[model samples]
Every structure is written in structure tokens, then in C-alpha cells.
Target: MWLGSEFCARHILRHCDTLAGLPAFWTREQHGEEASTWLLFTHKYDYLKHLADRYRSRAEPMTRTFSITETAITTSPPRERVLLLLAVALMESFGIQVNLCLDPAYRQLEGFVLDRQRCAIIANWVDIDAVWHVDVNTNKPDLQRYADALDHAQARSAIAAKTPTGRLTALAGLLDLDWQWLTHRCGELAAYGSAGIADPHSRLLSTAGVDRACGYVATVATHNG
Candidate 1:
């Protein structure tokens, strides 16, 4: 018994046209009767591929154009490797189920993992204690990196939210990027489940979805920032 119905997922998609034709937007809460229905549906992979490519292109430039590691948290190992390790730990510790896509296109910054099993994004940083219903581990690199990434992402997002132009531009890009990932993820998960396969849907889901799903499931944060 999940949280919502197919109607709910459809409603959400209808309201946000950006979500149109995208897969894997539904939360576990919305998986009761609609799960099988959606699982049987087909998708346009070409569309999703295009969307992912475009988003990666848009976001990747920021990494190079700014030539800024911005505010990276370096550990004993490489930051990116540490980030990957941290991501794995949090998923095991918290049982988050968003699908993940590691280095899609072999782009370094494309280290997104989505938890399609849970209809969320697997964040590099998570407030495990705050949302995982578990004691906080102060020593784990996963925990620390998650904290740093969350703080940085939040601060930047807040600033972007405040700026009218920034907000508009970001929201537009995110909607498209997010929607593409969601659809691709949903389809992938459904396919896996159908074939009795068990790979994660990293490309279709993202950190953004994880953040949203955690907030909803754990009630750790309010969606209305």
C-alpha cells in the first residue's frame, strides 16, 4: 500500500507540464494501484536522452566557465571519489531508493544517482540523523560530504530563489532537467521490475528528487522554502 494513486501522479504531471511524458515522477506514496499501470506504459527514450544531454551541457559549463571548485570539501581521498563513497554509505544507512547514474557520458560532474525504488534522488549529502530515523554518525566521510553538499546546494539555491532572473532561469532549467530524469528513471525502474531485474535508475532520478522525497517521507523539511 503506497501513498497515492495513478490519478495523483497524473494530476501532478498535468499541473506541471514540464513533467509531461517524463517517467518515474511518482513517489512510493503514489504507487498503490497505479504502479503496475505505469510499469506497463512505454516512453520516448530519445526525448529523455536529449533532455539529459542538454541539462548536463548546461550545468557542466558552470563547472568549467567558473573554473571554480566553488566550495568543495576535500577529504583524505579525492573529493569526487569520497563523494561516491559517501553516496553509497548514505543509501545503505538510510534505505533511500532513488535511481543513480554514475558519470553518465563519462562526465565527471554527472555523478547523479537516483533512487527509483523509492521515487527520489540519492543525495551526495544527507542529514541522516535528521531524516533517517537513526543516530547521526559524526565521523563518516559520507555524512560529512553530504552535509557540505547540502549546505552548499541550499545556500546557492536560496540565493537563486531570491534573484528574480536567477529563479526564473533556474526553475525553467530544473523543470526540464528534472522531468527528463524522472521519466527516464520511471521507465527504467518499471522495466527492471517487470523483467525481475534489479539495477538502479540513476539517470532517471536525481539528487533533486531525493531531497524532495526525503522531505515528504520523513517530513524533515518543508517543500515551501
Candidate 2:
């Protein structure tokens, strides 16, 4: 219900830039969905060759454009070796960005591993913790950056009276987060030019079908990411 509404809003606001993480976009292009459906997938050699050629053309500029693969989190190391490491390798081979929709229960080891990949993360507000949930993490050569601001601005509470400000300070205050730090982090992300993605319809269709599937990510950041 919430996601469907969000997709509708995006359609009214912006045309999608790249339709990342949507298999149906490639698969229904009559790109058959097979084993690739269960595994981390990308465009086939056809589109890939094109991406490669494009990568070479932009070589002199030493720049490449990328799309995100939002995966469900399998959570933690050994699982990541296959689930993340290999997938990251495959994406980088063709040039793509990877972001994980991480659970706030994520551990310190994850911080270290993700730091190595310089991968970005999306964190939800519910995980019981506070703003420590970093919304997105971007890979910058020799740098690890974070976007702490949320795509989510206001949240709903049952039987509560609310007003302007889009959110009430008193209720938000109950979250017990350090605002000074959160705002500062947002500034740092802006300074570094960190970016976030708003997805459109999958398959590059006129509009992404807002099914229960639209919000599907199992464990799905980087696979769960």
C-alpha cells in the first residue's frame, strides 16, 4: 500500500533514469528468466556488450555510469562471499553500483566488509535503533561515504494528533537520536555529492506495476541490499 503510493508519486515527479534491480525489465524484454532469477542478475551479453563498448568509449574520460542492484541482505560474511563478493565482482566487471537495504540489526563486521567494497546501504527507521541506521553508502575510491537522510520523511503513529513541520518534534524526539550528528552527516553526504535512487516501473514499462512484489527484497539488499 505504502510502496504503491510512492511509485505513483515518483511517476508524477520524475521519469526513471535507470531501472535497476528489476529482472522483469530484462527478462520480459524476452530475456528469459532462468537460474539468473534466483541469483543476482544483470543484462545479458547483448546489453552487456553494449555496456562494455560504452565503458570503453568513456575510457578517456575515466568515468563510467552505473545502476544499482538493490538486494535483500543474506546478512554477514560467509554468506556474502558467494552472495555479495561474486555478485559485486560481476557487476563491477560491467560497471554497476551496488546498494544494500540493510537491517539495523547489522553488525560491526558488516561495517568492515562493506567498507571494503565501498558499497552503499539503505536502512529502515524501525529497527529499534536510532539514526545510526545509515540510509545509503556509496563507494568512492579510497573513501567510504554515507547518506544518512531518509527517503522517508514523516512517519505515521496510531491515534496521534499531528500538525505542520510534516512531523511533530515531540513525537520524533521520542526516537532519542542525536540530531546534531544526523544533520551533520547529511551535510557531509551533500558535500561529497552522495546520491540516492528512486525507482520507477520495472521493465521500463510505462509504469512499474505496484504489486506486493514491488517491495520484494529477501534478506534483498545487495541480494537483500
Tens digits of lDDT, candidate 2, 47-148: 333444544544221111111121322222232322222222233334332222222322121221122233433322221234223233344741232212
After superposition, the stretches of candidate 1 with alpha carbons farther than 4 Å from their true spots are 1-139, 162-169, 173-225
Per-residue CA lDDT of model 1 for 133-182, tens digit only, reads 21112234543443334334434442244322233224324223242343
TM-score of each: 0.19, 0.23
Worst 10 residues of 2 by lDDT: 23-32
- Give stretches of model 2 more than 4 Å off: 1-43, 59-81, 97-225
- The alpha-carbon root-mean-square deviation between model 1 and the true structure, to one decimal in Å, is 18.5
Candidate 2 lDDT: 0.25
- Model 1 has a clash total of 24
Local distance difference test, candidate 1: 0.26
